[model samples]
Target chain A: MTLETTLAAIGPADEQAMAAARELQGRLTKPAGSLGVLEELSVRLAGLAGTCPPPMPEPAAIAVFAGDHGVHAQGVTPWPQEVTAQMVANFIAGGATINAFARQVDASIMVVDVGVKIPLHGGENLLEANIRRGTHDLAVTAAMSEDEALTAIQVGLSVAGALVEGGAKCLLTGDMGIANTTPAAALVAAFTGASPADVTGRGTGVDDETYERKIDVITKALALHEPDPAQPITTLAAVGGLEHAALAGFILGAASYRVPVIIDGVIAASAALVAAALAPNSVAAMVAGHRSAEPGASVALANLGLTPLLDLGLRLGEGTGAALALPLVASSVRVLREVATFDSAGVSEK
Target chain B: MTLETTLAAIGPADEQAMAAARELQGRLTKPAGSLGVLEELSVRLAGLAGTCPPPMPEPAAIAVFAGDHGVHAQGVTPWPQEVTAQMVANFIAGGATINAFARQVDASIMVVDVGVKIPLHGGENLLEANIRRGTHDLAVTAAMSEDEALTAIQVGLSVAGALVEGGAKCLLTGDMGIANTTPAAALVAAFTGASPADVTGRGTGVDDETYERKIDVITKALALHEPDPAQPITTLAAVGGLEHAALAGFILGAASYRVPVIIDGVIAASAALVAAALAPNSVAAMVAGHRSAEPGASVALANLGLTPLLDLGLRLGEGTGAALALPLVASSVRVLREVATFDSAGVSEK
Candidate 1:
C-alpha cells in the first residue's frame, strides 16, 4: 500500500463497536452505568472488531522503532547515535523504563530496529533490522532516502501485521533515536504551524546552548525541504527519522486491523501527527498515555485532539509511557465488560 | 476526638502500600509493566487494604453536601441559593453531567442538604441533612455556628460509616452550594497563602462585575477570620461552609478506614485542605478527579500535592468528576490483578 494511503486509512469510531462496549459495560456486576468513557471506549473497540469484549486486546504488541537523525552530527543532543541502538537492546532486555513498565503491564515488546547506521547482526535477543540502516542526516539532506522511508514504514507495517497474525489484538507505538526531538519539533511546527520556539524544547535535559542549536538544526532542515503539510510522510521525510516513519505506519496498521493503539511521548506523538494527517479517523484508534515534558508532544496531541492521562514529568522514550496507559485502557474495557447496567441491577434511575 | 484529632485521623501512603502496588503491577497480563499509574494505584490500594486485588470500591457512597453562602446576596453570583437545592435534585435525578458519569462508573449518589435554605425532605435517594438550614451570611458573621460546623462534619462521618457498612471500599466527595464558592475561595486562600485576586474565580459563570464582587467578599471574609494556614479545619469553621467541614470529616473517615477517597473538584479539594490539616495523611487517600477551572482548585491541589485526571472544561460541583475517575481506578486494579509476569510470558528481560 502507498504510504499516504496507509496513514489515511483509519475511519471514525464505529457505532456498532461503541454499542458493543456499552452492552458489555451494561452487563458488568457493579452499578449498570458506572464505567463511563471506559464503556464508550470498549464499545468503540467492539464495533471496530464487531465483537464483544473486543478480544481483550490480548498479546499486545509494542513496536519500538529506532532510527538516527542527521541533525545529531551537528550536536543537538549530548548523547551519541550509538545510544539509540544501545537503548533498543536495553528495551529488548527489559532494563529500560519502558521495559519495566511493559513488564508491569504484561505487554510484549518488539524492537523493530527500524534504522541504526550500525548494522545489527542477528543477536538472539535483538531483532535484526534496518530501514536503510538509519536516515540520511537532515543537516545535509532529507532525513531518509524516499525508498528508505517507504521501507521503514513497511517495516512497521510488517511488525503490525506479524503482531496481528501472532494474535496481538492491540498495538502500542514507541520510538527510539538519538536527537529525535529535533525532527519531532520540526514535524509539530509544520503540522500545527507552531513556531519552532513553541514546539522545540530541552531534549534529554539539554542546556540552553544545545537547545538553541537543536532549534537551529530543525529550522534549517525545515527551510531546506519546506515539506508540505498536505503530504505528511514527505513532511516526515523532510525532518523525520526512520522510527517516525515506522511509528506512523504501525499506528495505521493497528487502525486498519481495527485494534486499539496507545501512543507514547513526543516522538510517538510526532509520528501520530503524521499518521493522523494520513488518516483523520485513525486518531480514534489512539489513546494518549501522558503528556511528556517535551514541547513537541503536547503540540502534536492538541493538534490531534487527544487528552493525555498522566503528567508526571516523564521524558523517557520507548513504549514505556504507552505501556503505562495500558491499565487505563484496560480499565475502560473491563468496566464495560464487568460493570452492571441499571436494568440488570434493578437500580432506580431518573 | 477533638476536631483536630478527628481531622488528623487520616493517614498518608505507607511504604508497604507502595511496594504492594509495585509488585502487583509486575504481574498483570498485558505486559510486565505497561499500565503505568493505574497499575501503581491498584497496587498501592492492595497494600493499603492488605489484599492482592484490593476491594473494588463498590456500593460506593458519594456525599454531595449542598449549602449556600450569605455572600450571594452581595451579588457575587448571578444565580440564587435556591439553585443549590435545584441542582441537588438534578444530581439525584441523574440529569447532570456528574449523574451521567456516575451512572457510567457505578457509584451510588447521595445528596446531603447540609446548609440549604429550603426545607427538602429526604427520600431513599437523599441523605437527610442540613447544617442549620444554611450558614449565617459570611458577609457579616462566621459562616456557621461552631456547633453547626461540628455537626456538619459528623454528618460526613455518618455517611462514611453507612457506606462502608454497605460495602464501599472508597468514599467519593462532592458538593453543591450557591455563592459557596466565596467561602471555598476564602478557605483556599487562607491555606495556600495566595492573594484573593489569584484564588477567586467566577462561580457558575459570573460577569466581571460579579467576579470582582465575589473577590471582595472573600477578601473581607479573610480579614474577619484571619485564618492560620497551619490549622485548616479551624480555619474552615471561621470562614468555610458547613458542607466543606462535613466533606473534610468524610475524607478523614474514609482514610481512617483505609478506604481511598476520590476528591471531586474545587469544593472537595478545598475541603481536602481542611481534611489534610485535620489528618496530615488525609491527603494520601485522595485522587483528584479533575482540575477545575476555579482558580482556587489548582492552588488547593498544589498545596495538597495532587494531580487530577480529567480536564474536560468541567467546573461543575458534584462527585461526578471523582465518580468518573473510578473506572480508571478499576482499570488499574484489573491490570495489577490480571496481567501476567515476565516468568509466565517467558520474555527475557534486561
Candidate 2:
C-alpha cells in the first residue's frame, strides 16, 4: 500500500477487545493486576488484534534498514562510513549480535539497502531497496528531498507488507547508518521541541572532543533547517537519514496491518517520533524494546509515551534490542492464549 | 547433601570469571557500557558459573512447593486453604498459569508436597517431601518445631541437588500455601527490621476489612514470637511455612552447586532472605526474577540487596514470573557468547 493509504488507514486499537482481554486477565488464576506490565501488554495486543487472547506474535522478522549519512563528512562519529555496509554484510552473514539474538529467538532477519553508499550483492537475506547513494550533508543542506524521503519511507512500508504477508506476526526495527545518530538527535530535538544539547549523545562511544563536535553538528543542522513539527515530512527530509524515514514508514505500515512493531534503540526511537507525528495512532502499535543508553532515546520515548520492556542499557540500533525482546512479547500473548481460567482449571478463586 | 553442608559450601562467585566476562563485554562491537544491565548480568552469570559466557541457563526446572498454613485460621487471605492442594492438582494436570508459562519457556515443573494438610496421590511430576500436615498457628505458638523446619529445608536442598544432577542448568522457586503471605510478611519484617504493617499486604485480593485483618494477624504473630533476625532458623521455625523453609534450602543448594536460581514473587523473596541469612553468600547465585506486587516482597528484596529483573506487578506465588523472565536471562548470556567483538566484525571503534 502507498504511504498515504497506510497512514490514513491507521486507527485506534479496538477498545472492545481490550476490555475483553482485561476481563479474561482478571479471570486468570493469578491475583488481579499481579502480572504487571505483561498483563497490560497482552491487553494492548488484544486491542491491536481486535480479539481477546490474541495470537502469539511469533515468526518475527527484523528489517535492518542499512543507509549511509552525508553527516559522516562532519567527523561527528569516529567510525568510517564503510562500516555501515560492512556491518550489513555481517548481518546478512548471520555474524552480528542481531543475527545471534534473532536466531536464539527463532526470528528471521532481512537487510534492506535503503541508502547505503555502496552497492550490495544480492543474497538470500538481502533486499535491494536503495533510494539513493546516501543522504546529503544535513549541516550544509536538507538531508534528502521531500519526494526522496517519501520514497524511502515507502520502501520501509513495502518491506513491512512483505514480511507480514510472508507470515511474520511481528515486525522489529533495525537500522544501520554511520553518523546516523547525528540526524537522529536532530529529528528528536525537532519533534520534541527540546534543545540539541539535551538530546544529543555520543553515538558510538565518541571521545570528549568528538562528543562536543557531534552536539555542535546537530545544533547547527537544527538552526539551519528549523524543521517544523507540524511538517513531519519536512523534518525528516531536513535532518533524518533514509533508514530513519523508512523505519518510520515500517512502523506505520505495521500499524496499518494491525501488527505490533518492536522498536530498537535511538535510531528507531527517533524514527518513531516521526511516525507518531505522521499518524498519531501508529504509536499504539509500537513497543519500545529497550531503553537505549543514548540521552536522546529517553526524550523520544518520553514524547511517544512508551515504556521499554527491557533496560539493559543497550545502545546498538540494528534491531538487537527488539530481537532480544521478541520472547517477552510472545510470552505476554502465551499467558493469555495458553493459561487456563480459574473455572477451566477447576481451581478455587478468591 | 545435607542442608548444613550445602550452606557451608556456598561461597562468593568467582571474581576471575567475572573479570573475564567484563573484559570480553568491553571488546564487543557496541559501546563500552551500552549493553547496560545486561552486561552486568552476564558478568554475574559468569561469576556464578566460574566461566566467561557461562553455560546457557536452559532446561530450567521450577519446583512448586505446595503446603497448607495454620495461619489460614486467622482469615488472612480470601483464598480457601483447599486451593493449595487443588492447585497442585491443576499444576500436575498442566492446566495452571505456571504450567502454561513453563511450557512457553520450555521449562519443566515439579510440584513438591512439603506440608499439605491433605495427602496427595503420587504423580509423574509430584514429589512427596512432606514434613508435616501443616505448621501450627503462629499467633498461638511457633509455626513449626525447630527440627521440622530444618527437615523441610533439607527437602528443598535435596530437590535442588537432584534437579542439578539431572541436567537442569537453572532452578526457579515456586510456592503454594493458603495464607502463605501472612507468614511471608512476618518473615520479611523480621529479617528487614520492618514493622508488620509495613510488609503485610492483601494476599489474594482481600477486601478492606480482610486487609486490615491480615495486617493484624502478621503483627500479632510477630509480637508473639519475636523472631530474631540473628537466628534465622529460630525465626523460620517461629513464623515461616514448610515451603518457605524448603525454598530457602533450595536456594542454598543451588548456590552450593553454582547454579543460578531465579526467585519468583513474595514467597520466593522471603525464602531468599532466609537463604541469604543462612549462607551469607548464596545471594550471589540468586536472581530476583520480578518485583512482587506484595509489599513484603520489596522488603525481602531490599534486605537481600537484589533488584528484580522484571517489575510486572506480579503477586503470583507460582513460578509464572520466573518462567516469563527465563528468556531475558538466556539472552543476556547469548549476547556475551555470540556477539562478535569490534575486531572480529571489523567494525571501527569510536
Candidate 3:
C-alpha cells in the first residue's frame, strides 16, 4: 500500500481493548501490578491489537535496512564505509552478531539494501531495493532529494507488508550503515528539539577529534537545511539516511497493520521519531526494545514517552538489542493469555 | 552434598578465563564494549565455567520454595497464610504466574514444600520436604531454631543437586510465603546495614497502615534478634523464612556445581545475601535477574555488587523476573560462542 493509504489506515490504539486488558490483569492470580511494566506492556499490546490478550507476538521478523552515508566521507566515524557492505555479507552468511541473536530468538532476518554504496550479489534473505548508490553528503547538501527519501520509505513499507503477509506477528527494526549515527543524531535533534551537543554521541567508537567533527557535520547540516519537525519529509530528506527513512516507513507500515514493532538502537529510534511525527498514533505500535548506549537514544525515547524493555548498554544497531527483547515481549502477552485468574485458580486476593 | 562440602567446593571464578574472554571480545566484529553489560556477563560466565565460551545455560529449572510465615499472625500482610499452599497447588496445576513464566521460558518447575503451615498432597513435580509447619514469628522471637534453619538449607542443597543431576543448566530462585517480605527486609537490614524503613516495602500491595506495621515488625525483629552479619546462621535463624534459608543453600549448591543461578526478587535477593555470607565465592555464580520493586532488593543487590539485568518494577517473587531474564542470560553467552571475530568475518575494526 502507498504511504498515504498506510497513514490513513493507522489509528489510535483501542481504548476498550486496553481497559479489558487492565481488567484481566487485576483478575490474574498475582497481586495487582506485581508484574510491573509487563502489565502495562500487555495492556498496550491489547490496545494495539484491538483485543484483550492480543494474539501471541511470535514468529518475529527482523528487517535489517542496510545503506551507506555520504557523510562517511566527513570522518564522522573511524570505521571505513566498506564495513557496512561487509557486515551485510556477514549477516547473509549468518556470522554477524545480529544473525546469532536472531537465531537465539527464532526470528527470520530480511536484509534490504536500500542505499549501500557497494553493490552486493544475490544472497538468501537479501532484498535488493536500492533507491540510490548513496545519499549526498548532508554537511555539504541535503542528504537526499525529498523524492528519494520517500522512495526509500516506500521500500520499507513494501518490506513490512511482505513480512506481515508472510505470517510475521511481530516486526523488529534493524539498520546497518557506516556513519549513519550522525544522521540519526540530526534526525533526533530535529524531531525532539534537542541541540546537536545533546544528541550527538560516539558512533562505532569514534575518537575525540572524529566525534567533534561529527557534531560539526550534524550542526552544519541542520544549519544549512533548517529542517522543520512539522514537515517530517523535509526533515528526513535534509539529514536522514536511506535506512532511517525506510525504517520510519516500516514502523508506519506495521502500525497500519496493527502489529507490534520492536525498535532497535539510535538509528531505529530516530526513524521512529519520523514515523511518530507522521502518524501520532503510530506510537502505539512502537516498543522500545532496549536503551542503547548512545545518549541520543534516551532523549528520543523520553520524547516519545516510551521506556525501553531492556537496558543492557547495547549500542549494536543490527537489531541485536531488539532481538534480545523479543522473548520478553512475547512473555508479556503470554501472561495475559495463559495466566490463570484468581477466581479460576481459587486463589485469594488482597 | 553437605552444606560444608558445597561451601568448600565453591571457589572464586577463574580469572584466567575472564581475561581470555575479554581478549576474545576485543577480536569480535563489533566495536570494543559495544555489547555493553552483555560482554561483561559473558566474561563472567566464562570465569564461572573456567572456559572462554561457557556452556549454554538452557533447560532452566525453577525451584519455587513454598512456606507460611508465622509473621502472618503479626498482620504484616493482608493475605492469609493458606494462600501460600494454594499457590503451590496452582504451580503444580500449571496455573500460577510462575508456571506461566516458566512455560514461556521453557523451564521446568519444582515446587518444594519447605515450611508450609498447611500440608499439601501428592502432585507431579512437588517435593515434600517440610522442615517445619512454619517458622516462629520473628517479631515475637527467633523465626526458627538454628537446627531447623540448617535442615531447611540442607533441603535446598538437596533440591539443587537433584535438579542439576536432572540436566538443568540454569537454576532460578522462587519463593512463596505470606508475610515473607518482612523477613526479607530484616535480612537486608542485617546484611547491608540499612535501616528497616529504608529496606522495608509493601509486600503484595499492603495498605498504608499495613506497610507501617510491616516496617515495625521488621524493626522489632532486628532489635530483638540483634542479628550479626558475620554469623549468618544466627542471623538467618533469627529472622529468615524457611524458603529463604533453602534458597541460600540452593544458591550455594549451584555455585558448588559451577552452574549459574539467576536470583529473583527481594526474597531471592535476601537469600543470596545469606548465601554470599556463607560462601563468599558463591557471589561469582550469582546473576541478579532483575531489580525488584521492593525497596530492600536494591540494597541487597548493591551489597552483593550485583547489577540486576532488568529493572521492570517487578515484585512477584515466584522466579518470574529470573525466568524473564533467561533469554538475555543465554544471549550473552551465545554471542561469545556464535559471533565471528573480525578477522574471521573479514570485517574492518574501527
Report the lDDT tens digits of candidate 3 across residue range B292-313.
9999999999999998999899
| lDDT at A338, model 1 | 44
Please give me the DockQ of candidate 3 compared with the native complex: 0.83
Question: In model 2, which residue pairs have backbone atoms overlapping below 3 Å?
Answer: A34-B314, A36-B312
Off-target runs (Cα >4 Å) in candidate 2 are A207-212
Candidate 2 lDDT, A112-185, residue by residue in tens:
99999988777889999888989999999999999999999999999999999999999999999888989999
lDDT of 2 at B45: 93
What DockQ, between 0 and 1, does each candidate earn? 0.06, 0.63, 0.83
Q: Against the correct fold, how does model 3 do in TM-score?
A: 0.99
Let me know the DockQ for model 2: 0.63
Chain B structural similarity (TM-score) per candidate:
0.92, 0.98, 0.99
Which docking band does candidate 2 fall into?
Answer: medium
Candidate structures ordered by lDDT, highest first: 3, 2, 1
Would you list the C-alpha lDDT of every candidate in the order shown?
Answer: 0.73, 0.89, 0.93
* 1 or 3, greater by lDDT: 3
State the weakest 10-residue window (summed lDDT) of model 2 chain A: A28-37
Candidate 2 to native Cα RMSD, angstroms: 2.0
- Model 1 residue A206 distance off true place after TM-score fit, in angstroms: 8.2
lDDT of 2 at B216: 88
**TM-score (2 decimals) of chain A in model 3:** 0.99
